[model samples]
Target: MSWAAGEFSQEEDRYSEVLRRQWGSPTLRGIYRDAYGADYPEEADPFGFVTRTDLARITELVAVEPGELLADLGCGRGGPGLVVARERGAVLRGVDVVEAAVTEARELARELGGEAEFAVGSFEQTGLADHSCAAVMSVDAFWMVWDKPGSLAELGRILRPGGRFVFTTWEPSYLDHRELLTEAGFEVLVHEHTPDWLHRQLAVYRGILGHRRRLADEMGQTAAATLIAEARETRSVLATTPRVLIAASTPA
Candidate 1:
């Protein structure tokens, strides 16, 4: 997710701080591992509800060929995109608004020895060439964009003809997500319910609440407090929100 429209710099600084603090918390990592089990990426640290299985599904659905460029929008820490690119033999271009996230993603790519690049960009202004990517993938970050139509249009602009855009996001019942995709000139291919997402996400939140002391020790009180607050805020809608994995494509 990105800032409401013009507040990009503020959100960038804020999220960069969050990433610097949150990524080093062993307690948080444990919470994710405990909740997700083998589904969590051991090397790529992604901040989203898309489990390892969800990522695998994304990898398969993207259908990227070897040497093709795959764009990962809102790519936090660059883990999921790196994993997908490696699995599919694709070059990765990861974009995030957070400078810290882009930094971490670049480091992760170097550590993993993958053909990838990370950039400071957002859903609305991805700095990529038109029709530059064979596929695009986003984890749980798509819903946070305030300018959904514009972002979708940006995705359409960057993706090649017939290229896939696969992502996981939560939608309230009132929103017509498919309509939005169609309006942006994409053909909705698959939109499936991810029933396990709620339970897994709740478990992570509960784990944070349960391990407050440890989290504070590792991530600092302010960061832990922020996580606790977000966990609490997220719990209110986890049940009502519908989690989905969607795959769409540009005109062939």
Candidate 2:
């Protein structure tokens, strides 16, 4: 990947340190891998809650052209970046805080023989040069950032004039949501709501867990207990959160 000097701000540096610490831990990584898979395969499912449709929509909005330089912020496992690079024949640069995730991404790129590169770093502080990239995108990963304004400003700096910047996030209606792009220098180009089927599927999953304890005799006690625990946690969080699909671009 092309490197730049002193790209991250002080606030970004602090957040990156915290994220790196958490994602770099072996225990936490294992837990995440167990729950989500090595590459988060569920993210690619259209009906899944944290699906890759957001990234797909961003690609459509950005209209990635052949040979374009594309930078993927918070590119977990590099799956979305690899797909975009392969389809558009773009040079892909991916950055993530998790070391193992970065390693997996690099391996995938190598196997696919695509012009892609991966790095272990935070999206808030990627050392990419100003006006160097043709497009910038992120997939379901911006929420962890502590300084939304600084992060978006950095994205603006790296993108060439008139270049596209697109990403997905939990909708503002979601709890713990932050306004990073508006505070920085991006304009929303398009917004697509998730389909009804997706909401229905999520509801089913939630409903099953709500009464999992009562149905423990029918389902295996171990499975029911585990499902109940997971459901309890997910329901507690989702009660106040709603995911969103968003695309934005830097001023031409």
Candidate 3:
């Protein structure tokens, strides 16, 4: 896909920098692995708080037939989507706004030897052909998009009729926007809080905060500072805000 010179909004540019810096940081990776425990797929190198149970639930919710196409929106590093697609025998198309993330995800896909592709794209503008995918998923990534309505419209545009839409997010709405989903041509199938998400996120944030000095040494000081700041800010609201897993489908 091609892009205009100024196509990316400022938010995308800033997130690109954050993902670029934190992409291959060993310190941060170790923290997440420890936080998530033994079931965590270390090779996949997930970028956020996702338990193995969460992945299995997502796979079940997606319910794609063998050889069908699954789109992973905001698929940072291609871990969660890769695992789900592999479990369901589905092909994978992963999209992210960060170029560095897309590059890393492509490399990971090559290493894992799966039918997967990654591209630099945003939630509001995936650049995917209309009705291209049988199922769509985003793991711990949807909350990053400030324009929820536009992104949902893009999701509706790309997914085929009757396609599944499964995502784990903790936005301010708590994934209870039934009206928004209806307007965007989706029927809400599942919406429930995942309390374990809070525990895992808190552990990860505390781990990051505790390892700031080591993270600074491994990744740059700038990246370490940003992570520390984010951990502090995010953890403050995590306990109060609800993390949710939501499943929806377009009308057949």
Candidate 4:
């Protein structure tokens, strides 16, 4: 989920630090692997909400072809993108600003034995060719971006005509969601707000963090507590918050 409306730099540090800590913990990794029914990403699902169920929905929504490309933005460790690639028989391209995440994603792609690539890039510039991707998905990463409008423009530039863009993220109650998307040359199709679902996932996340309290302590109590506290905060305001799945298409 999105950390906050304004946590671009702070979000980056938290993401990388948490991911690094989780990657180093075998017990926590095992828990996440079991959660996914034995197929874990190179690391855990940092977002904590994109379960296997969401994976299937996204795969079907994108409707990718065998030779098509799917670009995943803020694709930490390439979990969702890799799964979508495998499910749709589509090539995978993941971009993240974190070098560590990009490295893990590349390794995961190699380990999974697929034609996938990961790059260290920013939200406003992905370094991809124009009109090259057939579909794109960003999971729980867009809110951390400093330039949502520019990022949407970049997605429009890279996506082929009629290419679909799916984003699963959270939005504050105060924003006009459609204005930026429309301004970036997209036709917004569906925006499903599922705050109840998001709240349940947050509970699961808190349970996971509580279950691995010892591991969290080993990593550092401050980090673990910070994560759990954030989850609690989200739960408190989930009624007002909107956990969203936005599907839009590039103009033909």
Please identify which of the two predictions, 3 or 4, would achieve the higher lDDT against the true structure. 3
Model 1 C-alpha lDDT versus the unseen true structure: 0.83
State each model's CA lDDT, in order.
0.83, 0.59, 0.80, 0.72
In angstroms, give how far residue 61 of model 1 lies from its true place.
0.6
RMSD to the hidden true structure, all candidates? 3.7, 9.7, 5.4, 3.5
Higher-scoring candidate on lDDT, 1 or 4: 1
Runs of candidate 4 exceeding 4 Å displacement:
1-10, 26-47, 194-196, 208-215
Worst 10 residues of 4 by lDDT: 1-10
lDDT of 3 at 250: 94
Give the lDDT of residue 83 in candidate 2: 72
- lDDT tens per residue, model 4, 132-196: 99999888787677677878888889999999998787667665567788888889887886334
Residue pairs whose backbone atoms clash in candidate 3: none
Encode model 2's per-residue lDDT on 68-128: one tens digit a residue.
8899888866777777667678899998877766776787677677788888776667878
lDDT of 4 at 220: 63
The parts of candidate 1 lying over 4 Å away from their true place are: 1-16
What is the overall TM-score of model 3 with all chains considered together? 0.90
Looking at candidate 4, what is the lDDT of residue 59? Answer: 83
